[model samples]
Target: MMILVYGGSGSGKSAFAEKKITELNKSGIPLYYLATMQVYDAEDEERIKRHRMQRAGKGFTTIEQPKDLGNIALELREAKSDILLECMSNVVANEMFSDAISDPSIYDKKVSEEKSFDKYEGVFNKIKDEIIKLKDSCNNLIIVSNNVFEDGNIYDDETMKYIKTLGDINVFLAEISDEVWEVVAGIPVRIK
Candidate 1:
């Protein structure tokens, strides 16, 4: 069952995903949790560590991949493991330069030398392919992504682009997923 869950920040997406993982583990199915966050700060590291500890006794194999989810998915395929990609939004954010939005110069400066459009499109393609592969291979693949479309002025250039890219990703994943859910106040309501 490939379940794709989305929710706004502070809407309990992570907690819901963890709960679902726990429920799946109780059924004697092997569970693998794939986390794609790259912790750059002390707070982020600590938070991620706490999340790990939360699943310590839950019989889950946790794989932390900050980038290259394709490689991680391929490894899981080799092992024939049931995996859950906890989130995708962070994966894109990790691959993109941290200052890409704040300082467009980092990317714009390289635009002349390299086609930024093609580069980003390639990145999107790679991620999309991995998502499709995981959807096909895993018994229970749960994808957690943020619901960022509910607010903010999406007309701004950088923000609009980011929203559109993520929206495309969400739509593509939803099309492949067996179930699509949206969580609000820790309650999961099926959207599709």
Candidate 2:
């Protein structure tokens, strides 16, 4: 089974996703938490720490795969374990902006204008394919993503590209997921 949980920041989406995983594991199957956020600053560190505290004693074995989601299938020890991916926003950002996957020159104004934001379509397709592979490798896959399109503020070209890529990936996830949920103010509202 595959589930997608989405919400804006601080909407208790993670908690709700965790609860759903626990509920689904009635047979005591191994639970894995695929931590996708990379710590780049003190704020990032603090947020990761808080999430760690929240998952304490939850029987989850953490697998830190900030990029290359498909590679996680090789890192898992058990074949029938359930996996929860905390967020897709970070995954998309990591893949889209990383010097490893994308040329650093892409950010240069001259280069950006020449290449156009359409370059992100490749990143979007890569993420979608990796997610499908990961889901196929696990017994159950639960993905938590942020609803960042509601801010209603225009951003710079680079930021807009990242937002659009994540938004597209979220839509793809929702379409493929067996269950879809939107959490608002700690309430889990089923969307599918």
| Most accurate candidate by lDDT | 2
The per-prediction tally of clashing pairs is 0, 0
Per-residue lDDT over 1-192 for candidate 2, one digit per residue giving the tens place of the 0 to 100 score: 999999999999999999999888756678899998877689989999899999998888898988898788766535778999989998998887665335556456444355566679989988888888888788888999999998899997778888989989999999999999999999999999
lDDT of each: 0.74, 0.87
Candidate 2 global lDDT: 0.87
For model 1, residues 1-192, the per-residue Cα lDDT tens digits are 778889987787777777775665546566888888776689888978877786678677878876677777666675555676767888777665555645678767744463445556666787798787776666677889998787755474545555667788899889987778899998999989
Q: Which residue window of length 10 is worst by lDDT in model 2?
A: 100-109
RMSD of each: 3.3, 2.5
Give the residue spans of candidate 2 off by over 4 A: 100-113
